[model samples]
Target: MIILAATPIGNLGDASRRLVEALANAEVIAAEDTRTASSLLRALGVDNRPRMIALHEHNEVERAAELVELAREQDVLVLTDAGMPAISDPGFPLVQAAAAADVTVTAIPGPSAVLTALALSGLPTDRFTFEGFVPRKSRVPALSKLAREERTMVFFESPHRIAESLDDMATAFGGDRPAAVCRELTKLHEEIRRGPLAELAEWATGGVRGEIVVVVGGAAAASLDLPTAIAQVLALVEGGARLKEAATEVADATGLGRRELYEGALKERGR
Candidate 1:
């Protein structure tokens, strides 16, 4: 059997009893960081020392087959530095490999930075999307695609990029879009800053420290009428957007027909 254990994101006290027992009995452990896994065992006072092997992003695919084979003989445990495996961390490859080999896989669920940040974000949680980390470059275009996204959006970001990312988000989602920036979650310096995207962008400009999770409210429920949307498209075209690009963007934002918006813009231009 293959067991996937959830590790605490920050506070060690969040470790589950099942997680402790699993660690105590694991025959072979695949960890994102072997040193961190050792520290975790010591922190939890777990006595059993399983043979630990690294299973991080750089080597997971190559090691999955080996780990799965070992699981066939005895229980194999998988863990990340924090939170559940296969989230924004490593473990998916191993899970896929184990599944392909028909090996039994189970999970010991516990602490989660994703859930923790979302819960504290103050945004509507019923409908939300976890986007993981924002793309380093091309982030603007990436966010543009989500300009019409109705569900609240969650993202992980580095401290250095927080300000610029929030600025880009404001540009894509609108400055008035409500958002929250969660920093160092579950840690001693945990901070949750909530406001409009513009405000958050300005705040992050001073720089931030520690791990970060950004949660932004979705686009407004109300959509613009077709005529209003067409006018907006034309304005964008006048501002240098290609006719198709402007029409598509406005149509997406207003839930209008792209073809109709394009036709309307062209007709207005002809007039």
Candidate 2:
């Protein structure tokens, strides 16, 4: 069996009893960083020293098969530096390999920076999406794709680029889009800055620090007549989106019936 364990994002006290027990008894561990895993064990006062395999983004693809074979013989504990493995971290390939090998895979649920930030974000949590880390470059194009996203969006970002990211978000999502920047979550200097994307962008100009999670509220429904909505759908379709996808996108934003928009676009295209 392969066990995926979640570590504390910031606060040590957030580490669950199950995680501690797993670390204490783990025989072979697949860790994103063996050194960090060792530090966590030492901090948790887990005396048992497990054999740590360095499983990181660079080597995970090559190491996954080897780890899967070993898991057939012994329980392998997977850990990232923080949070759960395979969550925008290493371990996805390992899990895929394990699933293909019919090896039993399970997880010990615990703290997550994404959920923590979202819960504290004060945005509509009923519907949300975790978009992982923002692209270092091409952010405008990347974020433009989500311009009409109707679910609260969550993202991880480095402090150095937070300002640029927020600015780009303002451009893509509008300066007045409500957002929350959760910094150094659950840590000593934990800060949750909430305001419009433009304001946050300005605040970040002076520099921000530590682990950051940005949550932006979803787009409000736009008021548009069917003809206008259909034209937008056709534009997206011309830009390489599938007809159905384009219709759905526009429909979601304009609160139009998807089938009606799709049929109208099809009729307009046939004209």
Compared with the true structure, all predictions reach lDDT values of 0.87, 0.90
Model 2 lDDT tens row, 180-200: 999999899999999999999
Q: Model 1, range 19-98, lDDT digits (tens) per residue? A: 99889888789999999999999999999888989999999999999989999899989999999999999999989999
**Model 2 misplaced stretches (Cα beyond 4 Å):** 223-271
Q: TM-scores for all candidates?
A: 0.86, 0.84
Question: Highest lDDT, which number?
Answer: 2
Clashes of 1: 0
TM-score of 1: 0.86
